[model samples]
Target: MSFYFNIATDKTVTADQILEALGRPEVSVDDNKMIFHIPGKSLRGACVYHSDEGYEVGVNAFTPKTDARLTRDVAAAIAWLTGASVVPEDSEDSFSPEYIADYGGEDWVAERFDEAYFLARRPDDAAEGGPLSVAGYKRTFAVTPDMFEQDAGSLEDAIRAVMQVGIDLQTLDDREDIFAASLMSFTPPAAPPQSTLRRMFGLSKPVSNVREPYTAFFIGPDVRTLTPYNETSDPFYVHLSVDQKAVFRLPADDFFAYAEAAGARAYGAQVYDITISQADHAKLMQQAEPA
Candidate 1:
């Protein structure tokens, strides 16, 4: 899930014009794209693009469940950059009731079922090595709508829950023995049949359709990051069925340190900010400590 707003205007806006409007002299301006460095935001800058229609601005941060103020700020900045009144064209419902209803309450039993589905069908991870590898263990823990309404009295509460889940899941994945056992028990489905013509051309390969378990940390105004495990060393790392959807594997100790820091959460194991309660944070910290 991502949050972005596009405005169509009477006049075409150039990238430089947008940058000047943003009032950041250090912003990098390319042909039709401008990168705005938002302080206290992601290392990656908020991306803005100019087209004949107008300008489309997107925030680098996750969906603004807890704080949509940033998105609003970005929109206002873009409006100023374009020198035209905001004309909405294709705005996504960041917090639609339908989206919230999909959460279906905080059912750990359902989550376990979802985990079991992946374990039985998905291929093993080759990175961790051995027959019982940590290859294809994609698990997710989403902030349910019910969870949001109950635990998260406000947007801030919802964001905290999302961050807490990320820390908790990472800690759970640290158990290599448990991961190995789960992988060993499940048998991957046989690869699909290849056509005879494809076989002759050496293009016959079996493809598995199992998807990674994507934990939705934030449901409303969802945001995501896709990162490679080792870009330099393993640029073409292709072993699992769902390579693109795989989460980055980080060491448990390092992950714990990052997660424990106030307002920190993991999106694909990369640290991001979220406001969590001190009591809840401490409890997660205790669980994450060396056992």
Candidate 2:
């Protein structure tokens, strides 16, 4: 729940680079292994390090507003300096400097969003058994952002991240057409790019996945859409008209309970737990046009 972000890169981040990134901020390297600091308390306010997982840099923020703003800027700087991707702990997707600058900072509430993926839109695309049995997309316990950040290795960890955006969204007008779907599925970090997904559909790759079915609650909404696939087994594609801000991760039992409580439109199976590759992501979410 604290403000911390990881900058993931192919090249390992070293103390030497940390000094360069922050104008050589006073850093105390522990055995030349890690640097842990707190930004404004006169202690190690910022922590920068690389672990065995991959070349990385971890940054934390300040006061809620200051925290979001400052931490975001620093993280973006490091990510770009190192050719890395920033992974905000609360977010379901990785983003760049401009990406974070765009829309939906933390604490942004979703309003007028009343639609449910608890029902099956396309049964053939759903999985066999489970609450989403007839759902077009299907649900999965693996590959949610919190699963990695919280070290959710067991059912308990998954359950901890569960949050039903019920009551809050329940009273809003029915805007199923504009709201991105709740269809979620898991994809590995090295999952195939959109080109491969085009092949999966026996077609061609998409020019953009950030086009429609966006979350209307925000000024510049987060795009949300699924890749080419009529069935559940196809290589899940990029999300169109959808962008990742932050999303909740839930356990199966509780997930089903909430879905039932939400009073589904129809029953079958549908939902998601997805994480796409950087190459595919870049292909999917288009960049802003020059001003």
Candidate 3:
């Protein structure tokens, strides 16, 4: 399957210009496809030179990681050459030479760009082991009135701190079998009067009722650890009864909508969706945490 991005341009350019912009000279065309591979990368792809009406480029899937980079490179090349921007034919996302520098990894597609890019194609299939067998990834935390005495660059950064907590929890759970899903979403703000009696009694935990942003991203097939029924059990308990998956698993695309409604209502705080890759995570951590 070939993933395509459309480049809309008004500049009068020739096929030679497009090919040159591709920074490649080794190319051949047949009735099937124009084979051209980016230097030093296992990119299997073709290009459709732009007409006055704009043109498209596509790549046969090599790997999600490879394909994503190729998609961005070709699109960026075409956009740079034509002095225009590129948008995925499958999504509304538009990227110019400037934004082209944005990380276009597979994870970034779901985290920062349009999730539709991945959803349009079986993105998980691009991997060898395939995506984890999880229903999704989730993170829920109370957005304290302050970043607990830390300087949160933005509310979003504060949320990232919480998202990191969830990632750490699952990574230690099943090791490599899980914790591969990207991060997404956060809750709206919430506030409840601090209890006078609890403080007077020296109880010192922030109220859980505070605006607790909770969100789960169903990026994979399994979200929870399922316990199978076992016939052999201790005499104190039934052998057949075992714990089942309990993680919040929802494949619906309305995570943000749900966050909005829940925040506007009661109990649940507003949830804002955020999507990020492991590289993004490292970048976040490399920066000093909110002081």
Error of 2 at 119 (Å): 41
lDDT tens string, model 1, 1-291? 234556565566565665565565544433533544433221233455667776665542332221133233445555654455443233343322222223222342133223322222324342223211111112322222333334427545554444344333433434322221111112234546778999899886766565332211210111122212221212111112112243222233343364466445344333233333545434443443111
Q: On residues 1-291, what C-alpha lDDT tens digit does candidate 3 reach at each position?
A: 346777787765555565677665653222233333333232233445545677676654222233355456667776797788878766787877657647455564434223223322333344333221211112222222222124646534443443333233322334434333333344534556667898889885666654444333332122222111111121111011013232233322233343344342211122222333445333332432111
Model 3 regions more than 4 Å off: 12-16, 22-34, 39-43, 49-52, 62-64, 106-291
Which residue ranges in model 1 land beyond 4 Å of their true spot?
1-4, 10-16, 24-35, 43-46, 59-61, 64-70, 89-291
Model 1, position 257, has a per-residue lDDT of: 63
| Clash count list over all predictions | 6, 27, 18
Write one digit per residue (lDDT tens) for candidate 2, span 4-105. 566666665555565466553543334343543323221112344556544333332111232233344455656767776777666778887556545335
Candidate 2 residue runs with Cα over 4 Å from true position: 23-41, 55-74, 98-291
TM-score of model 3 (CA atoms): 0.31
On lDDT, who's better, 2 or 3? 3
Q: What overall lDDT, based on C-alpha atoms, would model 2 receive against the true structure?
A: 0.35
Q: Give Cα-based local distance difference scores for all models.
A: 0.36, 0.35, 0.41
lDDT of 2 at 121: 26
